[model samples]
Target: MSKTILEDAIQEELSFFLQAIHECVHTDFNCNRVLNNAVANIISSVVSGKRFEYTDPLFVKFMKCLDENIRNIGTANVLNVLPIVRYLPGDLFKFKQTLRNISMIDKEIIRPFIEDNRNNYDDSNVTNFTSAYIKAIQQRRQEGQNTNMSDGNLETCLRDLFIAGSETTATVLRWGLVYFLNYPDVQEKCFQEILENVGQSRRPSMKDKTSLPYVEATVTEILRCADIIPSSLPHSVPHDVEFRGYTFPEGITVLPMLSSALHDPDLWGDPRNFRPDRFLDTEGKFQKMNEHIPFSLGHRACLGEALARMELFLFTTSMIQEFEFRPVDGVSPSLQGLPGIVYRPQQFNMKAIPRAK
Candidate 1:
């Protein structure tokens, strides 16, 4: 049953991906359009009680929305970091106002159901996460159980999931592209490996990963070098713990230095260089390293990791197979990433020459 559900979810997500790709390649796809489309798609899927599929329009819109929202939120976060902008009296107010507006929109969308459930909650329309959560609350209420679920909690969870999942993945992709442009040899080697292993007729699938060592290595290297999220979300140590004779007090905030792990010399030889071969064994099989923790490790690791990996594999392979990325004219691609809650490549232009079939 669990496998079935997981498969269904994967199918649904793929449907949305297809739609977004269609828009990305054919339409005048901008950041906003992509984001709005993805949002609409996710909402529709939840409402319709259908499993996500790659061909679904909702999936397409969801991907677009996901992409655009990342770009917007990333920009806003960077601007907010400026000492002058941080001090601007109006900026905080504006941010709060914008957040309130978002909350209002969310409330309005779910209001009708809330009112209907004030006395007796309905389950028919509970397809998405919000509705599912509401239904769970209602079911507990019907059973005469004390339910502590609140609108505030629900809204916060939903907002975080949407924002984090979207922005982090998009930011990673942006950095990956920048790295590819900076190191064309690495990109070419990756493309060749993918073509030789996966073939050109059908798109590369997750199962093909084991057989495509070079491609997998390149992806790992990209994540390691990108280090999009340098400081992971704060994690509590739970109880007092000792590491290397140093005692860490209980309840103290522990910031997992993700970049340090990624760049650890013990695990990676010449950790500073962009070397995909580091992840490949003598037999040309993909090797997993303990230091590669971009999605992080332990219980609080990213929930959307599987989905993100699929996206990275497909999108990167597809784009590189189709285009030869080079630094535009005299302008060199910036290796220095713009720091934010998420690190991103500074706005850089690249010339993409379409590859001949």
Candidate 2:
């Protein structure tokens, strides 16, 4: 994406969040849907060249599809490991239905957007990613080269972009707010850092990331405590290897068990505790740790890591700068989130009192 498009998306997201916070002040509200809408629009613009209204039915369906897909992916089913198991009676592998829904939504909805972009393909005036993609495909065709670039592949790519880009960051931000409500002192410290560094007059940007160490640390802690993908995506042993008296054979699927490292008592003195200071040195500067592998590690790591980090910083900082989050009715949410392929906090509501400008 271009710099201008990124700036516009950031500004638009900030605007939506500010309005949502204003509406939730002194009242109980679930910020998840609103936050999802804002983040969804950013990815939507990149994939489809336009944003959707929060009230749009199609957008809601898209969100539902994304949610179901994530939930199903997190689930373990015999059918997942063996396709033959799917022939068994009953909804033993209901997750397959969820996967099918996702494919249907992508084929029915996202494909049309790609088609429209291809219809309006213009090399000089490439407005969005879809158009740019079409140009690339056309260019490859001109060379008579074998390419995997097709409408089906394009639709799948678009679906992957939205699924990877939208939900994960939004979930982190949602968990960020939950952490803020759980630890007010930490939240206040983050707010103060934002105020001191970026001020309340302007929205927080990626440029201000370095100036707000406490905010950065707090976001890091949120990623740590949340451990969104506790088990992480599965990996395979390339060849026979030995480690710690264990030998794995080639082509053997392995679970890296990231939760072990993330919450290891040795690395983090109090692994269960929410302490942003764990990521900060005595000098109050942000400290880096190899143990902080929220997005996994190595070559197959998330392609969207840069975008996710940028979104997390800007969104978390802007929220702390603009509002004071508190649990509704003096009730705190459970830290033990719903277990799945990706862990997420239990459904909860909060009050977002606007900070004094």
Candidate 3:
């Protein structure tokens, strides 16, 4: 959809997200679930012209399933290489369960949502992404032009929007919090940038992005360092190819190790360090590097890249303005992340200390 639509969605849901944190904040608080719900609501807002209350049953189930599928992806992907193992029985790889998860999501969430959008198609006012797609299909049919905008494709797009859009963005946010816990100085620096540029009276917006170079750099660095979707989605070998003294057979699954590019030593001399300044130029302005590919590069890159960038900046700055993420008992969080479909931080506890005005 359009950038304005996504921006509006984030701006609207951000209040609820901050409120959820306020209620849940304590000596030991895990904001993961609430973060997921908030991001999902943004997707819901864009997809169906609706947003779910954090406590709603469907909203809860929706967040749970999205998380479950992400948790399952690492294990389920193994069946891709050893297809025969599925016949051996049991949900060892969770491949069957992953299928079941998708079915559940489609039945309980996606199908009903898409059907509702179709049943209530509004041509005069195409608000959300689904309605907009329906409008396009209708226009195509009226013009007597065949189009691939079928219901099945619409369903797949909706699925991609929900799963990839929500999970990756939310996971990156979580990783950012973990990093903040580990590097409070960097966290404070970001907060200072927001405080100085946007101020306490106003919320940080996309307009503040260019003015807050340090904050922007921190977000960019988080995306680069987290590199959550390191291998990206698996792709089949298009043809026999030769690499550095190695050959791959056609049809073999190639997990492009995206981390290699992101963590390349030549690009960042000290790639292992969590230094946001690496993204800043000598004049202290945020500058992007061609080697950075957290969303994966080329045609297979993420569809929600723009939306993801907006969410990252808005959520990161807003949260920092509201609270200082701290480790339990002043201890630092481990930077090592759990590798899966998305490389994410291991479950960790931290406190969100509200900042003084």
Candidate 4:
């Protein structure tokens, strides 16, 4: 998808999200649902060539299922190590529910979309991810070049795009709010930068990213502190390899612990602190760090890194520009995270008091 399309999707959904927040002004509210809704639509727009309204019943139900699975998957993940546990008489670890969730999602949401795209498959009309994948499979079949690519793979890849795309990006924004509540000074700095560069008269865009170093640095710092997927998805060694006197056998599972690099004290002297200045250089410019790998590194890194980064900057800057995130009763939320496929922030509530435009 073109950056313009993605940006436009975000800008439109952002208005709805801000309006949702506006309704809850001065009242403590958790932004989890609204955030997931907005992020999901943005991703769906790119992947499916459509975006669902936040109030759409089917879309709302799909999001609920997705959220439930995300929460339960941490416990259900044990099924991978102890497959026998899944045979237990009940959904103790929520493994069954997770499977059911995926099935329902495919049946009600993803499958219909894929089928529609397949029936109306067009090479020239390949505008979105789903259409593009379908066209690839069609071309391969015409050339009689059969391989692993199939409809199942296309469905699975689409699922990955939605699940991984929405959950991680939304979770990071949740963490950003947590930090904002904890450190209003940092939030104020970010807003001041946005106000100076983009101004209150208009929303911040990717174009403003270059001029607003503090806002960029703040988002960078959020990703660093959030470290949503601390241990990235499991990777397999292509071949036997030796590094630092350690031999990695071919096809062995390797869980790259991103937290090691993200939170390494050696990389940042005060890595534990919520300091955005760490991402800013001596000249107050946003500085990229090689060790800062919240999205992991190399070929296996998160596929939606660019989209995720764009969402973070636009959502965060827009939020900071519109409102002041303040803690409830002057009490900040816990910094503790619930461990899962994606490290999620503890459930917390805050107020998004609108700033003077």
Q: Pick the candidate with the highest TM-score.
A: 4
lDDT of each: 0.64, 0.82, 0.87, 0.89
Model 3: per-residue Cα lDDT over 1-357, one tens digit each: 667778889999999999888876766987788888899889989998888898889878777777888888777777778888888768888777778778988888888888899898877878898899888898999999989998899889998888888888999999999889888899999998888888999888898899999998999999988988777777877899898999998999878888899889987898889999988989999898888888787887887899999999999999999998888888877888887777888888888879999
lDDT of 1 at 291: 72
Clashes per model (N, Cα, C within 3 A): 19, 1, 0, 0
Give lDDT tens digits, candidate 2, residues 1-357.
676676567677678767867876889989888888888888877677878777788878878877777667644355557877667776555756676777778766798788788777778988677888888898999999989988878887888888778878888888998888889999999888888888888998877878888888888889988888887777897899998999899998887777888899999999999988888899989999998999888997888787777778888887888888888888988887887766888999988888998
The TM-score of predicted model 1 comes to: 0.72
Model 1 segments more than 4 A misplaced: 1-89, 92-98, 104-147, 150-152, 330-332
State the weakest 10-residue window (summed lDDT) of model 4: 119-128
Model 1 residue 177 CA deviation (Å) reads 0.7
| TM-score versus the correct structure, for each prediction | 0.72, 0.92, 0.93, 0.95
Structure candidate 2, residue pairs in collision? 74-341
Q: Judged by lDDT relative to the true structure, which candidate is superior, 3 or 4?
A: 4
* Best of the two (1, 2) by lDDT: 2
**Ranking of all predicted structures according to TM-score, beginning with the best and ending with the worst:** 4, 3, 2, 1
Candidate 3 off by > 4 Å: 236-254
Clashing residue pairs in candidate 4 are none
lDDT string for model 1 (199-286, tens) is: 6776666667777788778888888998989888878888999999999999998999998899888777688898888888898888
Measured by lDDT, the strongest candidate is: 4
